[model samples]
Target: MRIFTGVILLTLSTTSAFADCGTLNAPTDQQLSSKAYQLQYRMEPDGLAVSQDFSVLFEVCKSDGTAVEGTPSVDAYMPMHGHGMNYRAQVEKLGDGKFRATGFMFHMPGKWQFKFDINEPQGSEQLTADHMVK
Candidate 1:
């Protein structure tokens, strides 16, 4: 019926809208390396936005370039602005050194430093990446 057809169209449009956001994973985008581990991360929706909920997907690897098992904690702040994000991102371990952080929202756009504190049997290390949000 017409209602069914309309629903189908609405579903398609919603799917396409998400698709247009693009995949945030890019090897060359943002990365950090330390004596403990190396981290590569990307922000969902391609670029960072102001006052919008976003997700950060990251892969953590050992110094020897192997996936690690650890606990990840996420935090963000603007050093220049002397303030941090109003929202706190929660980290979920996805196994194989992969994690997904959700509930992140930058109240305003600027140079916000994203940091991941990872803890493992060996010890803990902090990795940070600075992003310029418009």
Candidate 2:
């Protein structure tokens, strides 16, 4: 069973957007009926540096189940073991509640953490999700 640890943006219905990650625990049904987000990823070693490519798709409500519309500038940060992850996020919004963040490179890997920071006209929010990639 995959365990997901993060805030829920699933039940949101705003012109707002999201910067979330995916996992096995992600709802099999894309029809988000809650207040949460999910992501899927693939990590490859780029020479000596490891690059993390991922996408965070969130189903958020604007006001009481009114599907939100608007682009939420999304970004992902991969933190190193000793220091917080440096900002290497390459994020872009692809309309339709779909946003992508890539090129989150980590030169080394050991108990690393993942954080996504999303910016909207409303404001900005941060979420931290940790995982170890061997």
Candidate 3:
């Protein structure tokens, strides 16, 4: 009976963790225009379409929800820029419900930004974060 109880407790705990991660989705701006719930990633420093490579990732959910996890398709950005920039990274999904994106520098850094194009089968999501390097 003790063993049964322990097993049940473990099962419940695991399920809850995954549930917290919840259903994942990606919404492109094209999709966001239509869908009511869509997220956007905005980085600071204005104009330059790439960020300082050493910037900590800043992200937001669809209208004040959870902080995003998984490979953030579009997880970096600068203020007031179009979809043309050089940003490269391999966003990996860690088993513990987190993501690790290995990104490169944009040659030089004064004011840079990056945008990731996180994708789901249903659609694509975007999140942009940027920072400066001294």
* Best-matching candidate per lDDT: 1
Cα lDDT of model 3 by residue, 22-100, tens digit: 3333223212211212333222222233334532222333322333444455334334443333555555554333344
* Least well predicted 10-residue stretch by lDDT in candidate 2: 1-10
Q: Sorted by TM-score, highest first, which candidate order results? A: 1, 2, 3
Winner on TM-score (1 vs 3) = 1
Give the per-residue lDDT of model 1 (tens digit) for 1-134.
99999999976865454333323355565867665566778878667888878998888777654577766898998999898888778888887677899989998878999978888888988888888888
In order of appearance, the predictions have TM-scores of: 0.75, 0.46, 0.38
What is the Cα-based TM-score of model 3? 0.38
Q: What is the C-alpha lDDT of each candidate?
A: 0.77, 0.42, 0.41
Candidate 3's C-alpha runs over 4 A off are 1-70, 74-87
- Where does the lowest 10-residue lDDT sum fall in candidate 3? 27-36
Select the stronger candidate by TM-score from 1 and 2. Answer: 1
Model 1 regions more than 4 Å off: 1-25
How many clashing pairs in candidate 1?
0
